[model samples]
Target chain A: MTDQATADLWPGERTEAARRLLLAAVESFARRGYHATTTRDIATGAGMSPAALYIHYPSKAALLSEISRTGHRATLDLVEGAEAASGEPVEQMRRLVEEFTAWHARGHTVGRIVNNELHALPEDAFAEVAELRIRIEDTVRRIIEKGVARGEFEVPDSRTAARAVTSLGIDVARWYTDRSTESPEELGRRYGVLVLRMLGSAAA
Target chain B: MTDQATADLWPGERTEAARRLLLAAVESFARRGYHATTTRDIATGAGMSPAALYIHYPSKAALLSEISRTGHRATLDLVEGAEAASGEPVEQMRRLVEEFTAWHARGHTVGRIVNNELHALPEDAFAEVAELRIRIEDTVRRIIEKGVARGEFEVPDSRTAARAVTSLGIDVARWYTDRSTESPEELGRRYGVLVLRMLGSAAA
Candidate 1:
């Protein structure tokens, strides 16, 4: 089953049917990757006939588009929420790294689908997702810019630092697993300090 | 067409027939990805029949395995060569980041196929590639460790910092483009500084 935070992002869609179908698609896309996974495979994984899948998603690309759009919205919300929280720049960054890294690590299956399956979305959907991604990057970049202006951070370039910090967190989806000893929270804590240090902030 | 560095990596096999097939595989796999590409497509791209593809590669998976293995070895060699060059730890780190990032950016098509298509590799081959990957990580980690030990770098965690640094470069493959106006050399120079700062080294 998916975690509470990830599930909560899709509120009002908890009808049992949609949940099973979406969850099945996420797992299949994560395991076999988006290109290799078929709609029939997703339907079978969800214990449904192949014909039943179309009633919900219309097509495999539609399923991917929906997932990507939802994931991007959730990510944008998470980053923006962290950015808007009441705090000094340092505190804001720590919270941002913690939430971003933990989200990628804890909900890694969906994270993989969201991050790695972008190419699978139809052209129209990809444009929308790209705009959302730009907003997400801008949010992080603004935080870093504020930190530099406040003299709370001293990176050579705020934009590049933002990109590196984000890349550090997004990569958790590629490598994190339950078998690892580090919990999502623990990884978040570690990365928060590491990333802050990268920005020339002293460790907390 | 692939870049000169990528082409030169596969020297001694530059016979006309082999070059066309291999280059076509790299481009197709990079564009459409491995699972989505059929041998037929690759053959057509190379100006050969589908059956003719078998004369060079036993199967489509074999083609992927060859590309993945060759790419991994090439990457491993590149990173190791950078690390082993004579310099202080900080300078070594700079070279490593510059070369590594430039390679990923310049050869991003092959880089995508090599880094993103790992799951398409067969089990035994994956194990070998995995070992090479470990060595590559170790090479970077050891440089950071030496830097920390010698007081040349002051990272809270060498292993985590190395992972972050590598993740930063690997991500260029996902996002870099010639149309972006940031040349590979410029990107490499910028990243080299960011990574050194991450390691607590002063700018090179």
Candidate 2:
């Protein structure tokens, strides 16, 4: 992976060793799930000793919390950044869905870990992740609400619409495979059009 | 919790003891995930010895394969039954989405186990489960195709639209909570309408 992709996958982990451990944890967790993966497995995947793993992360759950928090924060940033781009609601929604879908597809391992491994998080960590999730949903809802207000979209319920939009993007992580014909960008474009149709947008 | 619900969750597991074991496996796998869950945990959940659990399920993977197979079959039966119902394309699509979404919500635990834990299944088991999933997707696709043929819907790509419909429903298993305001049926109804809108139906 490129440095930029690495940073995108696990943002703000500046230390190379720490980032390597985090990446290893993501792969192990994605393949075997959080509860099934051991510190030894993670350490081995990162080419480090178990003690070295602890030097970076205090416990397995700590590693999970860090990954969950960083992944959620990255996605939240992506959505907010997409929304901040100046455009009509339709264009903004299109861009938001496209970018969000591509990100999930491209970083599916981290996406799956962040999404499917939430149950393994410590209570406080789970709550922190939940807060990021709500903010992300609200950002999508806000965009849909704006579209409805401007008469560009016909949505019965912005909250439900937001959930559907996010669901469409999030589900990509669960199903996307390397053998799949569509690239992340291609899938994003298709979803962008499909989501527009879903919202009853004239632009669809 | 009802007998009917039990049968629906794990169809064809006739013996009461086996059904109990299956139910126990579902709970353990859903809570801790497949790889994390031991057969001993499943047996304990079912109030039996590990030896007795083995008599019914050869291994933990066997239990998961059964759950995965049964869940996929149940959903495939649901989509096909929905299609076999007498209705216009719009109503058929509505019923299909409604029932599929409600099934996932009501049986969220089994749904999660089936959809999320496929990797834990043995190779042949995974392929078997994949076949059932494809049938389910194809059933939805055929319904959408019929709607387009009958001039009842305006979907650009039936395959992608079918995927979106199933994705919307499958995701409910991941996110639905008892604390949520909407009941399974209510969420299903909401999704039914949203799907129609997604297809660009006049009824939407």
TM-score of every candidate relative to the true structure: 0.93, 0.95
- Tens digits of per-residue lDDT, candidate 1, B135-165, equal 9899899899988889888876677777777
- Alpha-carbon RMSD, each predicted model: 2.1, 2.2
Q: After superposition, how far is residue A120 of candidate 1 from its true place, in Å?
A: 2.3
Clashes of each: 0, 0
Q: Which stretches of candidate 2 lie over 4 Å from their true place?
A: A1-7, A11-13, B1-7, B10-13
Best by TM-score: 2
Residues B41-87, candidate 2, lDDT per residue (tens digit)? 99999999999988888999998888788878888988989888966
Deviation from native of the Cα of residue B141 in model 2, angstroms? 1.1
With candidate 2 superimposed using the best TM-score fit, by how many Å does residue B187's alpha carbon deviate from the native?
1.0
Backbone clashes in model 1, listed as residue pairs: none
DockQ for each model: 0.56, 0.72
Show the lowest summed lDDT stretch of 10 residues, model 1 chain A: A1-10
Model 1 stretches with alpha carbons more than 4 Å out: A1-12, B1-5
Full-model lDDT for every candidate = 0.81, 0.85
